[model samples]
Target: MSIEQRDQLVYVDNGAGDEPLSTREMNPLFSSVLEARLARRQVLKGSAGAAALGFFGLGLAGCNSDSDNDDAGDAPAADLLGFSAVAVSTADEIVVPEGYSYQVIIPWGTPILGSFPSFSVNNTGNDQAEQVGSHHDGMHFYPINDSSEDGLLVLNHEYVEPRLMHASAQGVSLSSGATPPLVGGLRPADEVRKEMNAHGVSVVRIVKGANNQWSVQPDSMNRRITALTPMEIHGPVRGSDFVKTLYSPNGTMTRGTLNNCGNGYTPWGTYMAAEENWAGYFTNKGDNPREHSRYGVPSGTGRWAWELADNGADEYIRFDASIKAADATGDYRNEPVCFGWMVEIDPFDPSSNPKKRTSMGRFGHEGVVFAPAEEGKPVVCYSGDDSRFEYIYKFVTAANYNAATANGSMLDEGILYVAKFNDDGTGEWMPLVYGENGLIEANGFTSQADVLVNTRLAADFMGATPMDRPEWGAVDPANGDVYFTLTNNTRRNDSNLNEANPRAANNHGHIIRWKEDGEQAATTFTWDIFLFAGDAGESGVENNKGSDPNGNDLTAENILSSPDGLWIDPDSRVWIQMDSGWDDPFGNCAMLVADPTTGDLKRFLVGPIDQEITGITMTPDQKTLFINVQHPGEGTSGDQFAGGSYSSTWPDNTPSTRPPRSATVVVWKNDGGVVGS
Candidate 1:
């Protein structure tokens, strides 16, 4: 089918709680994940608790549904179904399809170190390292070898949910025995401490079974790296005053990687996990009136106001911009300078300290895509900004490869560039080096430090094109074409639409593609809109123009709206994951597989109510699939609580007095063969 013709066959289901683009900023559904974490880590540099307070329970009516198709119930399970689908959206249960089973080998607060005792949900002996942390996000499975029996699972702990992760959920009240009120914002210090330690990555070993199953090996190399963990800094920007702090004492050392999201692994055998939205964790008191003006901290909002929590813990104090010291030497006025770079972890050795590769040029990095490895060639990477109207970026490591040196720290030296997409279907990679490219040009930028600390502003100054809401990205090994999820952008309405993001009220998002010239990731490339998303009925509409894939013209066989997670399987099959299906009549999120070579996309699996389909990975043998179910029943409250009142009593629902928890799941076929083969 032609690309345009294929687009006509698909449709985006918009049902309940589907708000306008502007309304999404305050959408309470999953805002806590963004507001509670991003504001404190990405935008602010201290006291995430206080910064998140300003956004407390700004409920925008959460919940969504998908459209129903008569064929949905009887449709043949896509060839991928030999492998069962597992649900990890809730903590109380781990659900897998019939014939296939799963167990919680590792759960939040599951003690890792022998020094600490097993976890008790009541927070009795929750040792941060020994116990599994909260809200698992992106993850990877490094199979041992072609015939090896086991591998390592390196997972990213995105953030903590105070209510579920700690003994007493913070920012919650006991009175009325109802859901916590949004008014008295800011979680307590203990809650913040638990969250801080929960922000890094975890590495655990897994073994296969005779029945084609997997389980965690407790003494099998399980380890945790928390917020307090010390790490090394590398690349041109390493140890530059931009990273030094009272905590590091050596400008070169930094503590932990926060808000780690989707990840990348090197052909040379290292793990690259991007630290995203990590700027909001610090507190810069609005005291400097001057500093506040420059960084865009709202004056009356009392930026980082929670830094004043009782006893004023040091961890909490770091977020405070109101430094008592007169100079940078004594006070942490410059604390916000430490985060937002891609952190490299050596999953093989638990003793290895993670390294922050600064050449990646800090931003709200959604994902980093590494080009296939080649000797004597530059390492190329593509990244995106999650915020609306933000920019997309790329990086080219200066150090050339030598297959012999493949795993020998490829990130040590590299150059970072921001993408500039042109209206004429072409684009260039603009180098963002220190003292170069008018980077020092003001918007309050005094030096390179300012440029890195405030990367979004830097990209803006460089004239980078703002994308629709770039999320996870994937590079096709078969064709070298890059595919990124723009998700949905409501702001691209009549007043703001452009060739790159050419749609208004874009509920369903499209995928953009670019093929590098002469096989060089550093070279200028040609670009085009790969697909448009909307209901079949909305074809030919303005915002939907150039989007309908099967319209007997240009936009055929395109995808529907709200494209969130994306991954390109080794076979060149493009897997698409969704999150905003609540508005659909179908009543859930879904997973779809697309053939970029043919522009043929088909729905593979759909999730249960109120859950986002995220984090898809495959075992090295390509025989197993692992997926993550995040916030399945996000809106459940005490008043609405019941056996089924919960958005979903997922996995295997049973009688349990436990709050819903997010988790990771493994799925494999009943027979030991290539999955989806």
Candidate 2:
């Protein structure tokens, strides 16, 4: 597939439509660093070769060291990753190592609750509320009583493609991500409702049978949290005027969580869903507030035009945040403010209402990753704003973490900090407080709530570093080193290139890792590049990329791009998943494993055509691994859709006419040994 074809696939799943380039007027810190690197390259050009320059350390050494604490879990045996690398593939199927096998489970529209309705293209809106959602992204597997055989699998549904969801769009010549043609300038109410129902999270109980295959089971814990579910508001922004609306006059509650992309699990066992690209779900035509404008809320209509539902119900109409009433409380003008938050849910408690944590500093959240919890220590976590030239944020709770009583309330009161990476390999965490760092009433920040509601604007005022589309974040449990994936930033040019983000027009992204000076709550840290993702043959500082420990170009066994979903296993093996649109040298989205200590990377699995490989998790014993395949066949064009065909029919190879369905695949070694062994 070509890059254009891959762009179409991305459009179908990306909630934010064609994200605008960052127009913030912050200083470019990387230009000097880039110049220094170039000068050093000239000095050592002949003697050491380019490879030596590629692997030279900036200021830090021993990028990955074995931890003495072993806080994550028991460290795996030596030679942690021993599996043979797989080759790049474009076949419409899951490809794993020779000894590994996989089984597909809980596909989109799979009935898990209510009357157990079977999946059908014509399923009612109500039926969709009870079924598994589409476009699975970030996920977690919570073991019941620490048993790897049975557990609750929780995952996020990032967005939905209408052409694949409704039978009414069968013969429609709609482009990818485009909604079906409107009937008399209004969409059918039920179709709109079903689309909303498919954008959220799913909590289902799955168990391993005698055959070693995981299957969904009938349990009270099984539930679906969609875009219409009632939820509570918590944290600094809660009960503030910024979030007050007709539906939530008290500002203590809101309805639904949308565009849930990356996710996290609290030390207390609660699940945190990051709301990404949620701004596109609402539109403000009258006058735009800074909150809406900074977050990229459209002025015309929502991405799906939910506000134009023919039924004209209040819930459906709230998508349009126009000034219909005089005050914010009397209209949905504040409805857009109620979103763009990290929603916390208690997966084990079916009756509990999910809470939108306002203290996390609302933006386009890719995901949240918590440091290893230490008793009596302040709880700390990090999140990245998944947008071009956005800043990364960290939150430290005012209260100490106690495993026995730690809950979502700990997130209610905290200090939100934006990162500022300096040119000298050191970085500081700038607090986004109301009265500090020029964030006072004179600067339009009246209170803490006001500062948080306009997090991006405040970060801009505080001079936070503009990153290259920061995506999923992961913390190494053994050493507390933080890692973040700066997926491709095509907008980056020579004028803004820095040592941290070295590439100009970075087509293939890189991974950045940092270690706090002393404690997890430290204000400063030393950082370095973990690896640069690119094609196997490309080799140069400007266009090609290199790996860490040994600066060498990627090999056929390990080439990847758009590193989105990331995870560090208990043994410190770095698992990276791709969400790439560049499929020329790299065939399809794949999952690769890297030995953090040696920086030895290898491809573990490759996914089907036109799909993003994301949302990975494994059982406690490392025997059962689960990964999501999102929007398989997403590259299908208007002609293919009109002809009743698709680019892929994964997980359901039978019935060639069946549309592709996003799903979770369970993988394990046939010999029942540890995965990736």
Model 2 residue runs over 4 Å out of place are 1-32, 39-62, 67-77, 538-542, 655-657
Candidate 2 per-residue lDDT over residues 1-677, each given as its tens digit: 22333222122322324342233456545544455666645654321112222334433443555546458576654786889999999889999999989999999999999899888889889999999998998999999999999999999999988988788888887766888888999999999999989989999999999878888999899999999999999988888999899998999989999989999999999999999878777878989878787787778768888999999998899999999998988989999899989999999999999999999988989999999999999999999998778889999999999988888899999899999877667889999998898999888899999999999999988888989889999998778989899887776787887667777777778888888888899899878777778876555444655453345557888888888899998878889999886667788899999887766889999999888999989999999999999988878888988987777878787534457999999999999998986
Return the lDDT, model 2, position 238.
85
TM-score computed on alpha carbons, candidate 2: 0.94
TM-score of each: 0.78, 0.94
| Tens-place lDDT digits, model 1, residues 451-540 | 665666667666777788788888877567787888776645555455556556676677776767666565587665555555444354
Query: What stretches of model 1 exceed 4 Å from their correct place?
Result: 1-107, 115-119, 124-126, 145-148, 170-189, 287-311, 407-409, 440-450, 538-560, 641-645, 652-655
lDDT of all predictions, in order shown? 0.58, 0.83
Best-fitting candidate, scored by lDDT: 2
- In terms of lDDT, model 1 sits at 0.58
Look at candidate 2 and tell me the lDDT of residue 580: 87
